[model samples]
Structures are given as structure tokens and as C-alpha cells.
Target: MDDMKKLLEEIEKLKKEIEELKGEKEKKEFMESEKIIEVIDKIEEIVKKGFSVIEGAVIGSLEGIKRSLQEKENGR
Candidate 1:
């Protein structure tokens, strides 16, 4: 969970970097723009993986809780 949180934080940092680069883009060269695009792609990949992991974790926890509740109801 903590790792997933860190990955999300990294995505935020990447977004900020892109924004900063855009502000200075007119003064920069074409290669810099290409680099920004590459970073954006990489960030997209990381965000996808991070969200999937977090989603799986949350679903699994919910299932566990549901099972526990069912078992208690059965016991009663």
C-alpha cells in the first residue's frame, strides 16, 4: 500500500515537471519536447500499474470482510 502511494506521488511529481517544462518550452529545443513526451508515456504506464495494484488490494480486503461477516451470521 505504501509502495502504491509512493508511485502515485511520483506521478504527481512527473506532472509538475511536465508543467514546468511546458512553461519554458518556447525557449527550449525540439529534443526537450520529445523527452517530455517520453516522460508522459512512462508516467501513464506507472499510473496504470499502481491503480491496478491498489484496486486489487481494496477488493481483496472487502471480500475478506464480507466472508467474515457471513461466517458470523452463520455462527449465530
Candidate 2:
């Protein structure tokens, strides 16, 4: 569970990084965007595997997992 928590945090960080990249105006910086895309894919793979390990049920998208996390946070 702790590992999954870290993976969730990484996903959030990746989201912020992608947003930040979008705000950049330099064309040179845009070239680095592909690297971030690769990172996002890798993190997503890890998250999917983590979810499979943590939950035996049908774990769909990251959005669904996020909602589950949010529900847990709200004491559902």
C-alpha cells in the first residue's frame, strides 16, 4: 500500500510536470516533452501493476484508482 501511495504521488508529479511543460514557450524545451511522455508511460505501467497487486478486482483506468484513493481519503 505504501508503494502504491508513492506511485500515486509520482502520477500527480508527472501531471504537474506535463502542465509545466505546456506553459513553456521555447521550442527547444518542447523537444524534451517526449522524454516526459516516456516517463509517464513507465509510471502508468507501474501503477497498473501496483493496482493489480493491491486490488484483486477489476482495476480499470488510473482515474478509477484515483477515485478509490479519494474515497479512502474522505473516509468512505
Top candidate on lDDT is: 1
Q: Residue-wise lDDT of candidate 1 within 1-76, one digit each (tens)?
A: 9999999999999999999988778657677888999999999999999999999999999999999999999999
Name the top TM-score candidate. Answer: 1
For residue 74, what is the lDDT in candidate 2?
100
For model 2, residues 50-71, the per-residue Cα lDDT tens digits are 8888675555466688998999
> How does model 1 score by TM-score?
0.58
Q: Which regions of candidate 2 deviate over 4 angstroms?
A: 1-27, 57-76
Error of 2 at 32 (Å): 0.6
Score every model by TM-score: 0.58, 0.36
Cα lDDT of model 1 overall?
0.95
Instruction: Give candidate 1 regions above 4 Å deviation.
Output: 1-28
